[model samples]
Structure formats: C-alpha cells, structure tokens
Target: MRWITSISYKNGDGEVALAFAPEIAQFLVQLKKHFTSYQLSKAAALRSTYSWRLFENLERFRETGIWEVDMDRFHTIMETPKSYRRNFNDARRFVIDPALAELAAKTNITAQVEPIRRGRKIDRLRFTFENASQMKLAL
Candidate 1:
C-alpha cells in the first residue's frame, strides 16, 4: 500500500488536501490503536529518509521493544534498490546501519540488529531497542 496517493494545494492560499488510498485510510485507523505516535516536529527534523522510515517502523513496536523482519521484506519496506539487494553487506552498511545510527543519535530510541542466519547466509534481522526516556525511568 502506498503511504500517500495525491496532494493538492492552492498556489497562494493556505489550503491543502491529501487523498490517500483506501488501504492507507484503513491503516491509519488501525494505527490509532496499535501504534505509538511520534511528534510531527521531531519526525520532520530527521534528515535521512532511512532514519524516518526506521523510526516509523520501530514506533509501531514501541511497546514490545523488539521487531523481527525478514531481509527481503525489510528491503521492500525500506524501498531498497535492486543493486543493494544483491549485496547484503552493502545494504547493511549503507541502509540499515546508517538508519539505526541516525535514530539513536537524533531520536528518543536506540536499536541493535541481530542477523538471523540460514546455514551460512544472513536471512532476517531482529531489532531490539527501547525508548530512551523509558530506559532512564526504569533505571
């Protein structure tokens, strides 16, 4: 499902409208119950697209503090390109690691990736993280 379908705004007027697909609308309804919402200000401050996407993904599992995603599905979710898909190391270095680093440095969360392997090849990634404020409170 696409995150956004179309956006329209007047040239000089202070009015705008966004049209989302039915699936996106349903997703938003479901998000209200299962997801932890982030402040728009904070989200807008993120400079990297990967960082923003990672934050949203992790926020959905904020309560659980852990998320497991297959590498293929993760790549799809991140909208990774075909070239990067062929090299796991490159994908990790350029995409996943940078995203995680940005999230840890700029946001209220921190995460680590644990690669799940099938024989000798990496297959999935298990992300474990916690809200920094929550961690402080627990300590």
Candidate 2:
C-alpha cells in the first residue's frame, strides 16, 4: 500500500497515486504520518481515484470516526487548482488521520490533498479515491 504524490508549488495543490491493499487504512495512516514537507510527489494523484483523488486510511476512520460521506461540493472545489485547500490544515483536518497529523510536523511528512467526489455505492469501499480531485496547499 505505497503511493506516490504530485505536489504543486502553486498554492500547494497536488495529485496522488493510488495503490489499494488489505492494509489500506493502516497504510494511509503511515502516509499521513510521513508524507509531509518535501517527501510528497505528483504521481500519487492518479493511483486510484475517480472524484475523491485524495487518500483515506480506513483504520483511522474506524479509530477516530472522522469520516465524511457527502463531500461532493468539496471535491468539486479541489478539481480546480485555483480552489484547492483554502487553509491547508483546515481542509485536511477532518478527512485525514489525526495521529498521523500529530506526527506529520515532527517528520515534516504531510501531503496537502484534494478531495474527490463519491459514487452511488462508495459507502461499500473501505478505501476509495474514486470521487476526488487534487488542488491547493493551504488557505
């Protein structure tokens, strides 16, 4: 469950590469904990996405219960680089893993992400980027 990322120097927007696995949730937790600073890449944007181009760890969702099911409007915004994460941290706070966030700054490993939209049965998929787009770094 390794992913590559595309970081944007412009407004800090970027893309992602998706790789699904049984440990997807745990893997994403690691990413949230380690993909900060300059470790981010661009390939990650295209890995496994449709609307929500960003990555989400299922384990984190279960542990923290910070899941968002209907974020179509947000994903719509990220589809354009011009309207990426307005307040970088603000955008990721709810979607990403919290423990990883606590450690992100320590290692400078955080990927400013873009949120994707969702499909009809997206609820069934544990790890899905099928409804997201990439854009922005911060507000």
Candidate 3:
C-alpha cells in the first residue's frame, strides 16, 4: 500500500504536511498501534541500519523491559551478512555491539546484552532495556 499519497506545504512558515493512504491513516488511528512518532523519530536518527532495525524490534517489548532471541532468529531479524552469521564475535562486533551502543547514545533507552551459552557455543541473546523516564518514575 502507498503509505503516503501526497505532500505539500501547509503554511507560509514552511510547515509541510503529508496525506497518508486511507488504510495507513486508519492503521495509525487504531488502538494499540505498533509505535509512536517519538520512537520512529529516534529510529530515524540512528546512523546504522542495524541500530534502526534493533530499535524498532526493541520498541515492541519496551513495556515488558526484555527481549530475547535465539542465534538463528537474531541473524534473520538483524539481516546480518554471511561472515557475521558464521562468527558470533563478528556479529557482536559489527552488528550487535555497535547497534546497542548507538541506541543507548542517541536515545533515552539503555540496554544490556546477556549471551546464553549452550556448551561451547552461544545459543541466544537476551536484551534487558529500560527507558530513562520510566526509571525516574520508579525512584
């Protein structure tokens, strides 16, 4: 579907406006929408595509405060390169670590990764995250 059908200047002060497709507008108006404008802005501000993808996924579990995924699923979700898929360190160094760090730096969310091990190999990655505002409310 066409997410946006038209765009125009709404005012003399250079304010712009968008006309979204009917289905897109209706979806946005629906209850329990997938994300907020703030989250989308934060994701857009990220430099790495990896960070953007991770931020989008993380927002889904923002309230729950944790996101866990097995190695295979993580690779699929992140869309990592062949080298990264073959080596956990490569994935962490090139994809996961930098993405997490960028998200922490650019957004109000902080995350920590815990890699679960199965014998001599990494099995899954657990991400525990928190919004700064939520943490402040708890204090």
**Whole-model lDDT, model 3:** 0.84
State TM-scores per candidate.
0.70, 0.18, 0.70
**lDDT (10s digit) by residue, model 3, range 64-92:** 98999999999999899988988999899
Better of 1 and 2 by TM-score: 1
* Model 1 collision count: 0
Q: Give the candidates in order of lDDT, highest first.
A: 1, 3, 2
- What digit string (tens of lDDT, one per residue) describes model 2 on residues 22-135? 456566667766532322343233222322233233223433334454344444533523232343344344434442333232222243333343553222112322212343
**What would the TM-score be for candidate 3 when compared with the true structure?**
0.70
Prediction RMSDs, each to the true structure: 8.2, 18.8, 5.9
lDDT of each: 0.84, 0.36, 0.84
* lDDT of the structure predicted as candidate 1: 0.84
| Top-down TM-score ranking | 1, 3, 2
lDDT of 1 by residue, 48-127 (tens): 88889888988888889999999889988899888888888898899989999877767778899998999988899999
The reply for model 2, stretches above 4 Å from the true place, is 1-38, 41-52, 56-65, 69-71, 78-139
lDDT of 2 at 70: 38
Pairs of colliding residues, candidate 1: none
Record all residue pairs in model 3 with backbone atoms less than 3 Å apart, i.e. clashing.
Answer: none
Model 1 lDDT at residue 72: 88
